[model samples]
Target: MSNDRFSMCLASDLFRVKKLKSVFVALILMFLILFLTFAVCWVGSNLVSKVEVSETPSIEGETAPTITQEEKDGLLAALDSVINDSLMGSGAICLMEFLVMIITCIFVGKDFSNGTMRILVSRGANRVHLFISKWLTMAILVVAYSLFALLVSGILYAFKNDGSFTGYDFGILMRCFSLQLLCNLASMTISLMIAFLCRSSGSALGVSIGLYIILSVALSIISTVVSLSGGNQDWMMFMPMQQMNVAASAGSYSTDQLCAVIIMPIVYIAIAFAVGVSTFVKRDIK
Candidate 1:
C-alpha cells in the first residue's frame, strides 16, 4: 500500500473508535471495576494485617516504635505484591480483556451491521488495509488502557503509603504489565475474529462473553485437578490468561516459562488475525 493510503486507513480507524461513545463508556466501566478490585484488596489487608511493635525498651519504658530492617523489607515486598496484583492479576487482566472485547466487537462488528465495510470494499478500499488498520487501532487502545491502569495503581500506592516508592521495582512491574498487554492484544484479536465471523455486534459480544465464562471455569477445574494429582500444570502456562495472571509473582521463572509468556500470545495473535483477515477478504459482507 502507498504511504498516503496507509496513513489514511490508520487515521480513519482511529477516528472511528474515537467517535464511538461506547468506547469511552467501556473504558470508564472497566477502570471502575479494576479500581474496586484493588480497593477490596486494600480493605481486606487492613482488616487482616497486624501491627508490628518493636520490642526494644526505651529509658521511659516505651517501645522504640521504629521498624526493623526486616520489617521494612517486608513492607517493600508487600508494596511490590500489590503493584503486581493490580497490573497482572487475573481479575485485572480479565477486566481489560472484556473491555477489549467490547470495544473491538463494536468497532469491527458495527461496520458490518451498518454495511460500512461493504461500502468501503465496493469503493476499492483494500480489505487487507482495513484489517490492519482495525488491528492496529485495537492494539493502541489496549496498550493505552494498560498504561493508564498502571499509573492509577501507582498513584493509589503512593497515596496509601505516604508517597514512598522505596524498593518497588518499576522495571519488573512494567515487564509483567507488558505481558498482560500482550494477552490483551491476543484477546482483542480473538474477539475481532468472532466479530468478523458473526458480523453482528450483539452476537459477537454475547459469544465472546459466554466463551470467557466457560473457559475460566474449565481452566480453574483443570488446574485444580492437576495440582491435586501432583502433576505439573505447566501446560496451563501456554494459555494467555494463565500466563498473564501468574507472571506478576513468578520470581523464579525459567527461561522457557518466560518464552511461553511472550511467545504464546504472539502465536494466538498471528493465528487469529490470519483467520479473521482471510475470511473478511473473501466472505460476502451482509
Candidate 2:
C-alpha cells in the first residue's frame, strides 16, 4: 500500500473504533480516576494541615501565637509529604493501571471475537498496521489519562493547601505520571498479546487478571522475604511494582531502587511489545 492510502486506511479505522461506546466509556473511567486522585490529594493535604496545627507550639506569654518561618516550612513539608505519600506511594497508580489494562484487553479482544478483525483484514487492512495503530492509539489515550490525573491532583493539592505548589515536588508528580503511563502501556500490550493468543475476550481477561494477581502475590512474597533478611531489601527492588513504589516514595528509596524504577518498566514494555507484535503476526485472523 502507498503511504497515502495506508494513512487514509489507518485514519478510517481509528475513527470507526474511536466512535465506539467502549472508547467513550474508557475515557469516562479515566476521568473518574483522575477526579478520585484529586479528591484523595485534597483530603490528605487538609489532614496534614490539621495535624500540623495541632502540633504547633504556643508562645509562652503572648495570647496570639506566631509561627516562625521554619515552622511554616515544616508545615508545608508535612502537607506535601503526607499528600504525596497517600496518593502516589505504594504503587497505587500501578494497581489502577492494571484495571485499565483489563479494559484495554476487553476492547481489543471484542474486536477480534466480534469478527471486526477478520472484516478489517479482508478489506486489505494489514494486520501489522492495524495492531500498531491500535496500540499507538491506546498508548496515547493512556498517556493523556495519566497527565490529566496528575494535573488535576496537583491543582487540587495546590488549591486546598494555601494555593502553594512546590517546584521541587513537581518532579515526584511527573514521575508518578510516567510510572503510571509506562505501566499502563506495558499491561495494555500484554493484554493485546493475550487476546491474540486466546482469541476470546473472556479468556483474555481471565488470563490477564490471573497473571496480574499471581505476579502481585509472588512479588509480595519476594519483597517480604528480602525485608526479613538482614539486608536493606535490595533484592525486592527488582520487582516492577516494588520499583514503582520506590519511585513514589519521594525520599525513602536508595539510588539502586531509583535505578530499578527506571529500568523495570522499560524492560516490561519492550518485552510486551515484542510478544504482542510476534503473536499478532502469526495468529490466524479467521
Candidate 3:
C-alpha cells in the first residue's frame, strides 16, 4: 500500500512480463503493421503512375492520351483521401486493440495457471498492487506500439508521396488517437476479467477469441435487418465494430454517435474493474 511497496511491486510485475516474452511478440507484430501500412501506401501512390504511364501516347502519334484530365484528377483525389485516412491510422492500427486484449488475457491467465500470482501474493505483494502493475505493463506496450505506428506511417506516407508532408498537425494527429488507446484499454479490461474468471490460459483464450466472433455476428444481423427493412442504420455506430472503426478513423459518425460509442468501452472497463479487480483481490490465489 505504501509508495515504496507499490513501486517495487510494479517493477517486479513488469519484469515478469518481459520474461513472458509478450513484448517480443508485440515488437514482431508492430513490424507486420508497418509492413501492411507500407504496402497500402505503395499501391496507392503507384496506381496513378501506372495509369499515367500506360496511357501516354507516343510523340510520333498525333492521337491524344486516353487518360482524361478528369480521370487523373479523380485518381489524385482518391490518393489524397487514402493518405488522410492513413494519417489517422485507418489500416495501421486496426488490429491494435484486439492485440492488447489478447496479450493481456494470456499473461493474466498464465499468472494464475502457473501459480505466479499465488507466489507473488505469498511474497507480500498486495493483490491490488499486482493488478494495477499488470494493467500498467500492458498499457505501456499498447501505447508504445500505437505511437510507433502513427509516427512511422506519417513518415512513410510522406516519403511515398515525394516528401510532401501531410498538412495534418502532428499534435492533432496524436490527440485524435486517444480514442484508439481508450478503446484498446477498455478491451484489455474486459479480457482481463475473462482471464481472471477462467484463471487458465486455454480457457481465457477460448472466451476472449469469441468476443470478436460474437460482435461480428451481432453486427451482421443488425446490418442485414436494417438493409432489408430500409431503416436508419446509424444505430450500428454504437456497436463494437463501428465503435472501433470510429476510434481508428476508418468510419464516420456524428458527434453524438461518437460520444455514445465511447461510452461502450468505458462501461466495459467499469464493469470489469468492479467484478474482476475485486474478485482478484479477495479470491484465494492459493
Candidate 4:
C-alpha cells in the first residue's frame, strides 16, 4: 500500500460522495442567507424612510428632539457596523465554520459507524497517510470556501454602499480574512478530532456543538472576571475567536497581537491533529 496512492484514492472517493456534495450545498445556502439578510435590511430601512414622511404625525404638545451633528455621526457609525465589509467577512467565516463542523461529523463519523474505516485499514492502507490526506482535503475545502465567502461579503458590502466597495482597503479585508481563516482551521481540526474519535455521527454532532457552547460561555465568564479585576486586556488576545473579532472590527492589528492570534490557532490545530491521529492509529477495528 503506497501512502500517496492510497491517500489520493481516498480523497478522490470522498469528494464524489453524496454527503460531501450536500455539504457544499449547505455552504452555499448559508452564504445566501448572509447576503439576503443584508439586502433585506437595506431595503427595509429605505421603505421605513419613505413611510416616515407622511405617517409620522406631529403632536401639538410634544416637540421632537433636535438631531445634532454628533448624534448623526454616531448613527452613521452604527450603520457602518452593519454594512461594513470586514464585519460581513467575519460573519460569513463564522457561519461557514458552523457548516464545516456538520460536514466533518458526517465525513469521518459515518465512515467509522459504517465500518468503512476498518475495511480500508484491512485493505493495507497506511493510517498516518489516511489521516494526513483527510486533513488536507478538509483544509482545501476550508480555504476555498473562506476565500469565496470573503469575496461574496465584499461584493454585498459594495452593493450596500452605493456600489463603491473598492473604497475600503483590500489589505484590511485580507488581514481580517487571514485571522478568520486561522480560527476556522482550528475549528476544523477540533471538529475532525471529535468526529473521528466518537465513531457515531449523531454523538459527534451533539458533542461538537455542546463543546462549542461550553467554550463560549467559559470564555465570556473569563473575560468578565478579568475586566472586573482591572487586569490589562492584552491577555485577551489569546482567545482565538475574540482575536478574530477584534481584527475584523479594527481592520488591523499590532505586530504582537497578530503573532499571538496566528500562533494560538496553530498550536490548537497541531495538538488536536496529533492526538486524533495517534489514537486512531492504535485502535483496533473489527
Candidate 5:
C-alpha cells in the first residue's frame, strides 16, 4: 500500500471509531463525573474556609475582622488546597481514571470480538499500525477527559471561593493528570493484551476489572499492613494510583520514588504493547 493510501485508511478508521456509540457514552459519562467532582470540591472548600474563619480569634480592638489582603490570600490558598485534595485524591479522580480505563478496554476488546480487527487488517493495514492507531485514539480520549475534569474542578473551586479566580497550581495539576493518564494507558494496554491473548472480550473485561479492583483496593490494604509492620513501604511508590496522590500534593517526593512512579507505567505500557502487537501479528483473525 502507498503511504498516502495508508494515511487515508488510518484517518478513516479513526473517524469511524470516534463515532462509535460507546465513545459518545464514555464522553458523556466523563462529563457527569467531572461535574460531580467539581461540586464536591466546591462544597468541601467552602466548609473548610468557614471552619478556618470561625476558629481564628480576632484582636480585642479589631472590629469583626474585615477581610484583609492577607486573609483573602489565605482563603484562596486554602481553597486551592481543598480543591486539589478532593479532586486529585485517591477517592475521586483516581477512581474515575480506573473507570475510563475499563471503558477503553471494553471498546478495544469488543473490536476484536466483533471481527473488526479482521476487517481492519484485511484492508491493507499493518497489524502494528492498527494497534498503534487504536492506542493513540485511546490516549487522546484519556487526556481530553482529564483536562475537562481539571477545568471543571478549577472553575467550581473559583466560584465557591468567591467570584475571584486565583490561579491554579499548574505544576501539581499537571503532575496529577500525568499520573492518571499513565495509569489509564497502562490499564488499557494490559486489557488489550489480555483480549488478544484470550481472543475473548468477556475474558478480557473480567480480567481488567479484577485487576483494577485488586490493584486499587486489595493492594492498598496490603501496603498499609506492610507500612504498619515496620517494613519499607517503598514498593508502594511504583503503584500508579499511589503516585497520583503523591504528585498531586505540593510536597516533594524523593527522586528515587518519583523515578519509580514514572518508570513503572512506561514499563507496563511497553510490555503490554509488545505482547499485544506480537499476538496480533501471529494470531489467526477469523
Candidate 6:
C-alpha cells in the first residue's frame, strides 16, 4: 500500500480502537500533575518560611559582612517560587514528559500483549508503515499532552500569582516553553523505543521510569564530580534534561548554549526513532 493510504487506514483503525480512551486518560493524568505541582509549591513555601538565615560571612577583602537584608530574607514567596522560571518553566514539561512516557508505553505495549501486531501483520500491512503510523500518532499525542500541561500550568500560575504578567519577559518565557515542548518530544521518543523493545506494559513501565530516574541521577553525579574537579565540560550541555532545566532557569546562558539545547533534543529523538524502527522491523511479534 502507498504510505499515505496506509497511514490513513491505520489512523482510522487507531481511532476505532483506544484513541479517545487514551486521550481521556491523558487529560486525567495532566490534572493530577497540576495538583501535584500546586502541592509541591505550597509545601516548599512552607518549608522555606521556617528557615532562619543568621550567618554573616566575611569576605577576603571586606572588613564587614556583605550580607544585605533582602539577601537575608532567604527565600522568595510561595507564589513567586511557583511562577518563577524554575518551576513553571520546566516543571510543566517534566510532568508532561512523565505522563507521555507512561501513556505511550502502555498504549503501544498493549498491542503486543493483545496480539494486535500479529493481527495487523496478518492483514498484510507493511511492518514499516505500521510502525511509522503508530509511532507518529503517539508523537502527536505527546505534543497534545505537553501543550495541555503548559496551558494548565500557566493558568494555575497566573491564578496563584494574582494574574500578573508585569515584568515578565515574554521572549524568554516563550523560548523556555518551546524548549520544554521539544525536550518532552525527545523524551517521548525515547519512551517509544523502550516500549517497543520491552513489548510488555509492565516491563516497559518499570524500565522506562527506572532508566529515566537513574540516568538523571547519574548525570547529576557526573556534573557534581566535574564541578568539584574544577573542569568545565561544555559537552554536558548536550544532555536533554540538563538543557531543559537550563532553559527553564532565568540565568544568562549564552545564545549558542540555547541553540545547542534545540539541536541536542532533535539529535536524541532521531537516534531513538531510528533504533525503535530497526527493532520493530527485525523483532518477531509473539
Which model scores highest in lDDT?
Answer: 1
lDDT string for model 1 (66-116, tens) is 554566557656754674466454555557777788888888889889988
Each model's TM-score, in the order given? 0.82, 0.76, 0.82, 0.85, 0.77, 0.79
By how many angstroms RMSD does model 4 differ from the true structure? 3.6
What C-alpha lDDT do the candidate models reach, one value each? 0.76, 0.66, 0.73, 0.72, 0.67, 0.71
Give the RMSD in angstroms, all C-alphas superposed, for model 1. 5.8
lDDT tens string, model 2, 1-286?
A: 5566567656765676567676566666655654565566556646545543325566689665556556766766775655565456332355456656666677677778888878878887777787777677667656765666566567755765578878855776777667556656766777767777777778988998888778889887876786787556775656655543443563565677667766776787788777777887887786
User: Count of backbone clashes for each model?
Assistant: 0, 0, 0, 0, 0, 0
Cα RMSD of predicted structure 6: 6.2
TM-score of 3: 0.82
Which of candidates 3 and 6 reaches a greater TM-score? Answer: 3
Best by TM-score: 4
- Say which prediction, candidate 1 or candidate 2, comes out ahead on TM-score: 1
Candidate 5 residue-wise lDDT, 1-286, digit = tens: 5566556656766686677676667666656765665666566556545543534545668655545446756776775665556556443455556656666666677777887877777887777787777777777766776677677656655665576554454555666667666766676677667766766667777887777667779677978899789998878877655644553542466678767777887888999999999988888887
lDDT, candidate 4, equals: 0.72
Once fitted onto the true fold, the runs of candidate 3 whose alpha carbons sit more than 4 angstroms away are 40-44, 52-87, 166-172
Residue 97, model 4: Cα distance from true site in angstroms? 1.1
Lowest lDDT sum, 10 consecutive residues, model 6, at 63-72
